[model samples]
Target: MAEQTQVHREQAGINAAAVRSAETAESTQQRLPRCRKLLFQFEVDMYAKIKTERLSFIRHNQTRLRADDYIYLHDAVADDRNANRLGNMVILPSSFTSCPRYMHERTQDAMTYVRHYCRPDLFITFTCNSKWDEISNELLPGQQSYDRHDVVARVFHLKLKQLMDYITTGAIFGAVRCHIYTIEWQKRGLPNAHILTWLWFHVPSTGSMWPAKQWFTLHERRFPIHARHPTVQHLSVHLENGQRVYFTEANLQQQLQEPRDTTLTAFFKLCTLDDFARTLLYCQLPAYYTFDASTKCWKRRVQGSSVPDHPGIYQTDALARVYTVHPNNRECFFLRIILHHVVGPVSFHHLRTVEGHVCATFHETCRRLGLLKDDAQWREALEEAATVRSPA
Candidate 1:
């Protein structure tokens, strides 16, 4: 009996320690300020130049420019030689000066083949974040001498491809229809890829399909759903006038006032596993909220229509089964939030229409600036990268 009592005490101590650690982490995260949003200057001129140059190249080939061809074809980025912060000319590579028409033509062919075979839905972009300390530490490893651009480009390429492989084949989301990736160098000479991937599937569209019924196969085992049933997953819990309150699916809509197009409802409906792990994610930071007596939850300022049932579908995510409904195509609330958080404001223009033309324009800019390597070098790199790849 003494031994059992000691084991119980140890377990209780571990649980208490874990709770304290989680609270500390949450408090720290809440204290951290969100990075300010910024826009890249290329948004103004790079895309226009690509469209003009791409048209001339295509017209001469006697081939029609299908909406999808933009994914593979393009021109070099145009930079204002006089607009530098330090007033010094940006020294770019010699090859970066001209757009390679032949290379883009070949890429167009590859994209055509992919479009015919794969019916992709979600279009995604993957760019390397220079601010990531972990990558900098690994690539720069103490006392290593290397061309900053070359090393950074190589590492980002390999890492991005690794992530792409995982996403396409992973159970979370199946095979992508096709993916077009091109590397570009920023004014500061940092290399990043403008990648466009069309996944094979996506979340159900909004409107008539709005509020998609939670998909699940009923089993012999029982599952928790409501708050009073103490064993289900919850977003929050607190004491309300001395009565213990839990935020479960039953009260989520009433207590949280979640917008119609938000993912909260769908997520909670599908959150069936009582023992499933939970994570807390704050919406916006540098902003604080106080619990409302009427709503019984934290009140914070948010963008998007609060009217519920805002018309028009703007975005979709298959893995999460979430949709953002907005009347305007470019004003997708959820996607904007994602771009702000994941890609940073510098690359905000990369987010665009589902057809992915603007992204291709960025690739064209890379080619014009000679940021993209010539066919021979690119082919050699692909051969080397493929040598160790496991066959499908």
Candidate 2:
């Protein structure tokens, strides 16, 4: 290309020195005509000049240009996390792409895929095999597979493309709804593709060992979740005050409010008139009844919801789970304990009741039940430390 360009430059009666070769551009050293290397520099210079001209125009026409804050990391970063106070933070903008920030951005973006398609069903790896006939056949007599990096790269690229086609076209994993893949170079300079395929929720006729429906069935049989209903959904516990509200932000345009009725409140209302409900524990609610989210209530299910053979029995395949509470939250931890032993609590205060006495606090209620261990050892250790050791 340089020889052809030089031919045209000569025809146009342009000076040989005009489009400078490496010899003219740098007096230090020039082994060969560096037009190929100089071509890269020419592009870089042209881009910078264009940017400089635009900035000059924008500055002159400040009134015409729409104003906004501009933060550019052209040469380097301008911000650091209190580097002077702690220590030096030498990381620059160029390094940021491979830094933790870049990794974090990619990981968060990966979650959006998981959320949309549910979790991935298959994890696949396509590593470049050095022994492939395509790469091995093209090698010279004495040369190894790694001798020609170009050949290895080209062959791997083509193979990866074909593999991707098979997955995306629903040929490999039957009816693959979607797939996510990433390519990485190993230490041997060979590329490999990591793939995650979200399979369609149908069992195919052939060439499929792990379709979504079959996978779920196998797992559910091995690890049943209490009892399986026809379907399960988010249920509101209205009697637990403000339990349904998620405080995601400190301020809102309008105050958030939940509906007045929920499963817990509905149960209390039901127990007032039904002796059966009063006898049932909170955890057993779903096994006996189905939640009506639209009405914010629980209704008796038709017979055979669980026990299909019996027509007179009231049983269901579903069971409502009283979720375990983290011990860090004292009140909730205490409440969960009482819910396990108590049946059909009408109110939060009722859960705190021990035997016949209405306790003032949930903590005191658990203590009365002998659920909380005494902290005499810890208390004595701290008291001794206070007298013996300095505050620091």
Candidate 3:
């Protein structure tokens, strides 16, 4: 159901992008070379026809609904009060992604949040500028942002998650009590987010305190927006044409001295010894323990952190985060799901071993534990039925 919701969200975005009027497309300079403007226009036209056909098909074939003579009914008769009436209509429910009902429910949810937390302190508008270096870097030859909106959309989604993580984790404007956002496409065909954030403490003006430029700028004092443990130097390097370079500790021992007493190793060791450590999931370690590279061990955190909503109680969240796993990868995906419950397994074989019986694969193990709540009963029934049936 969660996966279906995700799929619905993605399709909603794609459909919205697809059916948007080509007339609303931003005009580039008359002199500038056109890439796939005609292709985009064609896609728009096709999407419109597809949508109309789909609605018509649904109207005919789908369950027509009406209230007495208007909703959830297969057929309806004209009422005495009102003579003018059509057949029972196929209504778009709240589950229809960005339909009127869905949008209304979403708005109501935001209103409920506002009522709970009061008016938002920060009103941030995050624009997905196609000019971002990340987007430019990924574009193939002869391709523009408009040409590959999937890529643009994905990059925006990832960056939006990062931005939200920063805000919610109190990296900016302290902690946020609650946040609600809506994404809309501008007249320029660029997507932008209108975010309303309610901070924990009252602020006179957030803009004056933390300027937009500072949020974007990669200052020396701020944490670098680079990947952690990134390679200091590339293997294929041109020898200096009188270009002076110093040999540092990183140059000598970067590859060599990857210490054995890292977080994972220490976690495994601690799991064997410490009862408290054994209770923790893999990602929950950061809530109680901090990794010390110099000391080469996991140190217990004396002071725990709190979130905006749960200020009184210590939370395992925010201290660590795991990357989202796409459900398509069968073995890897199932293994990741299982690891949420079974943690600090010393080896891969140990991970596979559940309840003293080592399963052949993660899927079998998941079935054994009833993990992911898959249709195991139906699967088993099919296997049993296949044996009983004779070959045709």
Native-referenced Cα lDDT, model 2: 0.52
- Candidate 1 C-alpha lDDT tens digits along 1-392: 36445545555565455334323134565221121111122222433444444443334322211111111111100232211121112222222323454343334333332323433344455566665443455332232212233235545555554555555544235545455555555676565555445655653333442123322221112111110100111122111111121232233233224322112322222222211111222222112222244544333324322323423211111111112223243223333233222211122243332234554333343333343456643453354334323121
Instruction: Estimate every model's Cα lDDT from 0 to 1.
Output: 0.33, 0.52, 0.52
Best model number under TM-score: 3
Sliding window of 10 residues with minimal summed lDDT for model 3: 230-239
Kindly list the per-residue Cα lDDT of model 2 for residues 1-392, writing each as its tens digit: 36445545443432223233312223543322233445446545744554444444334333222211111111111353221132222332222334475554344334434544557787888899998777787565666766655456667766665666666664555667556666777997787877777676644446543333311111111111011112222233322453432111221111133323656677767667656677787767776777776786777777644444544437754424443345566676666666556787777777777889988877788788776667743364364334333321
N/CA/C clash count, model 1: 9
Report the error of model 1 at residue 308, Å: 52
Q: What is the TM-score of each candidate against the true structure?
A: 0.24, 0.34, 0.38
lDDT of 1 at 66: 17
- Which prediction has more favorable TM-score, 2 or 3? 3
TM-score of structure candidate 2: 0.34
